[model samples]
Target: MDISKLKEMPYDELRVLYKQHLHSLNISKATINTASVDTFYLWRKDSKTLFWDTVLSNDFESEARSRLLKTLSEHSSGNVNALVSGYLSHLRKFRLYISSDSTWEQSETNQVKTEKNTNLRRTKKDIVIPSPTVEQVEFYLTKWDGLENYHLQEDALNKLFLELCPNNTDILDILLKASTLNDFYSTNIFSIYPVAKHIRSLNIDTRLDAGDVTLVRDIQHVTISNKKRSFYSFATKYCSHHNPLDYPIYDSYVDEVLRYFRNRDNFSDFQNDELKDYVRFKDILIDFRGFYGLGTYNLKQIDQYVWQLGKDYFPKNYGKKKRGDK
Candidate 1:
């Protein structure tokens, strides 16, 4: 639990560490690496790490941690899987005492292969849904000539959801549920409410537009600290788009990754797919996803593992710094 080491090491070093520490494949019919062990030793020499650390230092409350983890289980499967595999990679890399033949990377590959494997399916409940062709997406999206804004929103939402959700049933359920919200913004278009105004301005390119968001100073004053009502009012603007779900609500993990990259590139905010670095972020994420089997596995799980892996291994650069900029 040396927070400093976890927060200071660059990913390249961490990647090597990953290959050393947990190198062996913990083949369990029920779980990959049961109990989620902290196998690697982070070099924590002092207590000055909190300047950037959050969960690792117990500063984040139980509620925050729970919400973060739940976000992984629900909205971000991709992050969870990234954490798991990356952790396994870290273990295999550092703990050379374990063995040299531990190609943990292959183990990760093999795990996906095992899941796809008909032989494994006969014994497991895991479901691998094929990504829908764009034709199917176009059909579903255009089937109903909804409002122009609704159509635009739905298209964006569909692409985001379908890309993230691999389980067919899960994907369909999410889309169906989201379709109802298409009209949520239509009625609010002329409303002067800050939330409404923000929502009206949010399109794909305007996603990062801070104008759509308002940080209200709702927290009056709680000098009592940690035990206050801690009330701060923030409005959820729907924007010109149909729904917020289209862009995965950058959860704490996502926030961390995004911030790292943003700060490294010195970007104060991102408003749309055109945020000078969108392409770069897309490429980095795509490469990472391809390295693993994101196209095949549950998108949420993949997200989880990736974010966790980044945090666990690339502590210094994981969520604090990124290089690419468009």
Candidate 2:
């Protein structure tokens, strides 16, 4: 298979050649589209030597032949019944490769193009949740202050812990009742004592850090039940009641909103699991604030806004809908 001969062959002949090679490799599921065939012809005409150089540079002859056969597969439209489209796309990229003679794997222009395409793909199905504006954050905060029941419940918990359990001596009692109100059902009834004991041992009366949060959350295995459970959200909530500014609550609503904004606005780069880590989570929250020019608002306020935003838009409940609900 002298590919140099392909350099002079007409476009129709190149298409036939690609089809023949693809068939010879037992790869005939896809109908090679005309556009890909045209690109292959142009690539061969303009840079067959460069293309061959890339293919034959492989150490093993079998590797080189495999590369060549891969390059010969045509791009497909509609359903991809074979692995041909990827190889054809690579051949398409070869035109850009030789045109720039870039030192890097991709030229700057190609890099931009690739990124643009990538972002488009990432957000194709994503409902673009609007990034928070100063007005929007303020609006949500105002909404938060208006929720009377929320304030009532939060105020009662604050008073109880600050005054009654100031040294957390009665933390076990506070937790037993508070768990129900705060919806810490995931933390077992019997585990409350152990979790309370762990918190008291930390003596986070004045300050709390990432390590403290991790310790409090990981009191699962030490519990009476001895089951593997994590109270990550519960830990954040408890620490937050003690020091709201230091510890941001990790509610599902807050988590969903952070992920949505992170995806939509590129405010921060973090793995989904990293949000479970207190320090990284707080840093990401700070980055979100800075990115959206909401620096005037504190983490607590930002938490309120994002949590409400997510509740309104990304509700997890799939329960039966009301008559007029969307």
Candidate 3:
């Protein structure tokens, strides 16, 4: 049947034509009842009938009703009841399908919108920490060049340790290197006597191979002159300097930087236990680095980038020199 001609035909003529098509398909009220609802719809869809296609495609109840009412008003002089009884009887079941589909779509859409709003609200309440751009990282690395060679101090400490105790060069090297690299400023330098005595007392190798928790516990046990807070800084700096790809620095500046990145990237908060566990922390760092496509940069270079950014943006938090502070 020519659908364009049917659109132009009078309501009675169109209804007659529609009935003829249904008769050709041998689809009667008895046949429709025998077929399942889904099967009937599928058969109608395959029939290539314009009216069925148009009605079925209007998945929303209101839209389907509006379309039917508009068509009826235009072609049938607003004779809705007569049109439904004669030609539009099939649309009764179609209307129910439209209503169910519309309700399900609306419910799903509302649920998605609610979740998005909740996440947005939570994000707004969070403090956004800034991440370093590639340009910023390059600039920071240039700045790092001015700092004195850490190897020189490490060599001196190693030589001094060898003189003090020849047998325990390995353990002494770990302790002295870690203590020297600590960025925390102090008037009283770390004394070798107490550190050496403490190293002699420990059974395990004082290096990071002993695990971060054990190393930290041992450092805290031996730390004198109120240097407890710097224990992590010392140990992390030591491990990261030796194995930049494997270990990341975990100082206050780095902590602030990581928190900022977490908020910015929408990552979950790090638990205290996870952060304290060196292997777990390393895994998180590896994941984060991979996520940002920062695999090419070593942890030390990444550390410099974050440290400089923290100082620039969070001066008070990192104790960076303020505009007026000497």
Best by lDDT: 2
Worst 10 residues of 1 by lDDT: 231-240
Candidate 1 has a TM-score of: 0.24
TM-score of each predicted structure versus truth: 0.24, 0.53, 0.43
Clashes of each: 50, 0, 0
Q: Candidate 1, residues 233-300: lDDT per residue as tens digits?
A: 11122221223322112223343444443333322345433222323333444443453334553333
Model 1, residue 119: C-alpha shift (Å): 47
Rank order (by TM-score, best first): 2, 3, 1
Q: The CA-based lDDT of model 2 is what?
A: 0.54
Instruction: Record all residue pairs in model 2 with backbone atoms less than 3 Å apart, i.e. clashing.
Output: none
Compared with the true structure, the alpha-carbon lDDT of candidate 3 equals 0.46
Query: Model 1 off-target regions past 4 Å?
Result: 1-192, 201-246, 255-279, 298-301, 304-326
- Candidate 2 per-residue lDDT over residues 192-289, each given as its tens digit: 66566665565555444332545435432234456655666666666666666766677666777788766654668899999877677888888887
Q: Which candidate is the best by TM-score?
A: 2
User: Residue 142's C-alpha lDDT in candidate 1?
Assistant: 47
Preferred candidate (TM-score higher): 1 or 2: 2
Superior candidate under TM-score, 2 versus 3: 2
